[model samples]
Target: MPTTINPLRYPGAKRQLVPYISKLLTNNNLAGSTFIEPYAGSAVVGLELLQKGLIKKLVLVEKDVLIYCFWKCVFYHTEDLCKKIEDTLINVDTWIAMKPLRDIINPNDWDILELGFAGLFFNRTNFSGILRANPIGGIKQASKYKIDCRFNKPILISLIKRLSHLRDKVEINWDDAISFMNKAKKDFIREQCFVYFDPPYFGKGEKLYRHFYLSSDHRVLANFVRQNKHFDWLISYDDDPYICGLYSGIGAKYCPFYLDYTVSSGKRSKGKELLISNLPLPPVDLSMTSSQY
Candidate 1:
């Protein structure tokens, strides 16, 4: 299966794990179920499922205001926003102007379309797609880098095409992950819904993201999942001993997944990953290369 390219750059995105996730869903006969993603950073996993017709409905909840606003624009107003992005040129001056806007535009007060435009520009130009903030809560200035592949017109257009089709079938929200999960659990039948969690990994997300999850948060999530044993669910996290110990012997299977990729400087690196699923999963090839999509 071809991987779907994410519309924006995100930290800890699950782009490479989509194929294995799809295989698991297919094996479990839950391909056509309603899918819910609570910690939807880039929403790559949910989008892939929707694109492949594996899920009949997609519910994506993101806590980050910038990401939530960007997805709102993509799903609600694709043409106008994409055209705006297409005509604009990315440079140092544009970046300078957008930095302040990113700091000031509260997702609650500003128009989502405008926020979307700002997010598009900021994400495309930022270093490594890492959304960082200064000590006083202003967006950090992006390092000067050559602009070429990041702002490709063809890729932007393709993203718009994929997102536009989801306007009716998708629901995007800005909410706390735990609260959203609790509410969502009540809305659908346990047998007809599949939840995929890509929460902040232990010891890693705190440094990279502002909305980092702490150890207590992880425990809360585990307790909730344990209590709700009837729901079909899967979670992805970095391979941490603490994380591994939390979900062990909980009627779940821990699968060690791997990804190999070259860094921006062309240095090769590999990482161990984990997928905790309540349903039976097919044997995964831990040696699979990372997706180029």
Candidate 2:
């Protein structure tokens, strides 16, 4: 599969796991199955699968309003959205000026495409790509600015062009993950389907992401997935004992996936991730790999 340039810097994106996921699906004869991504953060994995022609159909569901808008624009209005992002200057002054717009804009107003633009701007310029809201409900300013790493026109153009190819084959939605999963299971009963869950990690996600899943929310998700054992499913989470116990007790297969990368603290770190699957996966290899991008 060819590499895709992702403009959005989402936390805990599954770019590194794409190869392993592709291998698993191929070995299991599920390359041409219908693919569902319930918590589509960057929508990177689904896009990759679609680009590689690994999936017959693709469904993406994102709960965050801004992210949903951004993806909607990408799929439906690619050229216009790319032009808007390209023309906008990336500087501290521009970033500061966007604060009020972020504060005033109502996400419910469907006619406004600026929500998508604001999401693109802040996600590209914010520190570590962390989108935090202030106490007053506006976007919080980054503590430090690194002008050299700001968004560039070439990168945005490349990403937009790549996403435009899968517009017809992909369906993007704004809904809760569980709701999408429930509907999808019923809709694709005859066809082979694969569902990949990349929900908010139990502990770390609550602190980093603006919208996060609580422990109770995780439990609810676990129960739902456990009950529905018809579809091929895999969930990604941090390597925490609580999460491991939750899935292991339910008889799901759990394995470790590792990646080495730099963290927000400017230090190199290695993460041991867990993959819980309803079906058995291939043998686990502990070797760490860098992301293809």
Candidate 3:
């Protein structure tokens, strides 16, 4: 497990992949390049790279307004967000109060501060940091772990304050992933940019992600990656035949690798994940991965 810098705990977090990504960046002469993450969730990967000087800057794109507000608050309204974290109660009662934010049909219609605070509160308490899921100890508060298990005020506040200093080094955008890519292609210098796409899971996207892609939506993304293969781009997905075939059809280089995945129940389980990229990536495990050729 790599050092966790961000305050937000995320489901299927790729923070552990930082070492592999860092090595790839160095190997491709992309070190100190401007890194772009289209479907930035917690953005643990990009954050780690920037902090380590592996990337000079980062561009994070997220469509979920609540999530966007969280990043916006972290970057722009640092003291206010830190104060919110400092003075808040992390009991079951407060957790219940925060649950209503999830029911919000259109988060953009709500107050940015309210959504930002609620997102941070819910993410800290929720199992595996899944916004739609229940808190760690469950609603009954019977589990030994309890709701406040992941919310440490001093630690989170410190993390927030530290990250706020890098505001100029990051650009947060509230837009669809592919839409942002289309615009970024012209905006950022292609030679100095490295793009990483961590889209929703293939089979369980609808359940795991609030803004997941439909099959057609996924195809649209694949086509975009295919057309823009000239750019340094990498895409990650849960190991599935359909997802593997989708990129393979577009002549993308792909490989499957094993990683330990922690579930909502707080149990770590090993699973296979796939990475498809336009840039060169040798398979970590030859027996588990098949090339397009």
Candidate 4:
């Protein structure tokens, strides 16, 4: 529980793309729109959108109970959580060196600070930060040895900055994304809502965090989006030929981007990953600087 949640450590999070998203928003003059994230894992994009003052209202949904609970604490009991985290961090440097999983996996450690840090720790250190129950399913270790937090003043400050500029208009829900999207699509107007999907990769084998997603579920969602042509959406997925084929007949265009991989135990190993987004595949002829604005 944090008064303010940090944007870091979201598994498969898009915090790094804040600039790109902001640029797109600026270019499109998209403000005051209701930002909807159906599969909001840790809500990096939503949080960043709020921080930048781009969106007026946020509809963020996550299926996980722990993550949902963590956000609940942050929204309702931030001050107390901040105080507890501060008290626990004897020194900034020493605290940063501690692994996030050490507390999350341990049932006995349920302090607000531990919960808050656990969310972050799992995201940055776990395999895809997918939040699977088993630690062995993770792609990497939290750390080989703890780093001293005394010198990690910057880390402390960064977390504090994120905690300060929280949005008041955020709506958090714990529900299956596909079901939520279907209902949300029907209940809300088409033009005002925009969805950003970060579903699990297809054919990636059994996941350490298998509970978070399934290929069959993804198929259902993909079909829903494909059928719901009236809605505006941006779907991101691994660069698969089938994905390209699936959206080929649809109006959705593919844009390729890279996501750095921290976990190497699986097929992806350690390298920048290729992601295909059904969003506007930026004008091929335009320069990065021109399109950036």
Q: Candidate 2 overall Cα lDDT vs. reference? A: 0.74
lDDT (Cα, tens digit) per residue for candidate 3, span 1-293 = 22467888766657667777887788889998899999988898999899998999999998877788899999999999989888888988998777777766565678877788888888788877778878778889998888998888888888888999899999999899999888778766545889999998887787777788888898898888778745788888888887776777666787777766675446776568888887678646322211000
> Candidate 3, TM-score vs. the true structure?
0.91
Better of 3 and 4 by TM-score: 3
Task: Rate residue 154 of model 3 by lDDT.
Answer: 85
Q: What is the lDDT of residue 8 in candidate 1?
A: 75
Candidate 1 Cα outliers beyond 4 Å, as residue runs? 1-3, 11-13, 104-106, 133-144, 147-149, 261-268, 286-293
Candidate 2's C-alpha runs over 4 A off are: 1-3, 100-107, 110-112, 133-148, 285-293
User: Candidate 1, residues 158-206: lDDT per residue as tens digits?
Assistant: 8776678878989998899889878767776644889998888687677
Query: Could you tell me how far off, in angstroms, the CA of residue 171 lies in candidate 1 after the best superposition?
Result: 0.9
Q: Which regions of candidate 3 fall more than 4 Å away from where they truly are?
A: 105-108, 189-191, 283-293
Weakest ten-residue segment in model 2 by summed lDDT = 133-142
Q: Which scores higher on lDDT, 2 or 3? A: 3
RMSD of each: 3.8, 3.7, 4.9, 6.8
**Residue-wise C-alpha lDDT for candidate 4, range 1-293, written one tens digit per residue:** 33233534433334555566656555655666777888776577767687678877778887654565466556656665456445554322433454443434332346644565455434433334445432322223344422221213345445544544463788888777888877777666645666677676654524534344555576687688778865466676667776666666666666666654434343333223233344554532212211000
By TM-score, the candidates rank as 3, 2, 1, 4
lDDT of each: 0.74, 0.74, 0.80, 0.55
